[model samples]
Target: MKRKSSKVLWIDAPDIKARIEHLVEKASIDWVHTERIACVRSGNSSARAYARIWGLNQVWQQVLDVPSYYCIEVLSEKFDHLPEHHKDEILLHELAHIPRTFSGALTPHTRRGKGSFHDKLKQMIAAYARSFR
Candidate 1:
């Protein structure tokens, strides 16, 4: 069944839950339901800086007492600028780590399909950025 899109007002204007849901759908997976998921700007990040460490094309999290999973944080900048499809791709990348999944998480130090999955996701972010610049 197709999931209906919902706008998350707590987050920035561009951070519609629909985009995240779209990503989940594209990956042929489902997002774990949580009551207080939030998408916000990185505390010390800005657009002027490179996106790899912190920018519109990146995201990070601070895990708390929840042992199985932590807070899933996406940069407001990166959350706003990606194309629809690529946004979905990024969502898939992040969602791949949801509980049980074979692909699991992509490690930077390891290679996949002749190239690192990390590099490929970076390429996706870069490509998404280049489309605007």
Candidate 2:
């Protein structure tokens, strides 16, 4: 029997879910067992895409006591039409923000000489190379 699909608001499409799942699997980040990934539509016109880390805030730690979630917000107008390669790149970039700890905390990006973009690019290249061998 086929499995039922999870409900995803805003960007509720099969292709979007598949892309997210593929990126999450490839990311290999150690999110807590209960962590969830959601793709939402971005309301900001200037935003192309961004990953929002949830459950890491003080309220969650002090009250909810639950694992964090990663909400990947894609610009409804832009992301839905991007090429597959571009989507992959964007997803990979977001995944890179996640630390290996998977403890619901984020690895803050550095803006100094070797910035987040540079670091993410390096990691992406390495992962790409490993896929071939």
Candidate 3:
């Protein structure tokens, strides 16, 4: 009998990194400029989302004695098949998870039971579009 392997491989994604930097600048996401962000693409992920943003939580930061950081990983299978504008929207949506504090904590879909994450994302996407004009 042959056994199946399910190893996921992650590789540095310079293109995604560039896009993120451009988005941050164009959308005027000032809080992101100060945070350390790493971008990567993964293969063989079974997750349903096109991309995911991972945070270096406070507990890990304290334990490792390191500064806060975030990782933007796009699932190659789904992400590569998407159109450019959709890719930008996906990235922008992931970026919306970072709170203004940039403290390595993720902002939920509904923030603090008051602010709506999608509202901010829509505004940012609009700002990103208007930047080029």
Measured by lDDT, the strongest candidate is 3
Q: At residue 67, give the lDDT of candidate 3.
A: 84
Counted clashes in each candidate structure: 2, 0, 0
- Expressed as tens digits, the lDDT of each residue in 1-133 for candidate 3 is 7446799899999999999998999999998953499999999887888999999999999999998899999999999999999999999999999988988999989757677889999999999999989
lDDT of 1 by residue, 7-78 (tens): 423333235445544444443344344222333334333434212211111132222333222234555555
Error of 2 at 33 (Å): 6.1
Q: In model 2, where is the ten-residue run with the lowest total lDDT? A: 46-55
Q: What order do candidates take by TM-score, descending?
A: 3, 2, 1
* C-alpha lDDT (0 to 100) for residue 67 of candidate 2: 58
- In candidate 2, stretches whose alpha carbon ends up further than 4 angstroms from where it belongs are 1-9, 27-35, 43-55, 111-117
Residue pairs with colliding backbones in model 3 are none
Write the number of the candidate with greater TM-score, choosing between 2 and 3: 3
What are the runs in model 3 whose C-alpha is more than 4 Å off? 1-5
Model with the higher TM-score, candidate 1 or 2 = 2
lDDT of each: 0.41, 0.57, 0.92
Error of 1 at 130 (Å): 26
Highest-scoring model, TM-score: 3
Report the candidate with higher lDDT, 2 versus 3: 3
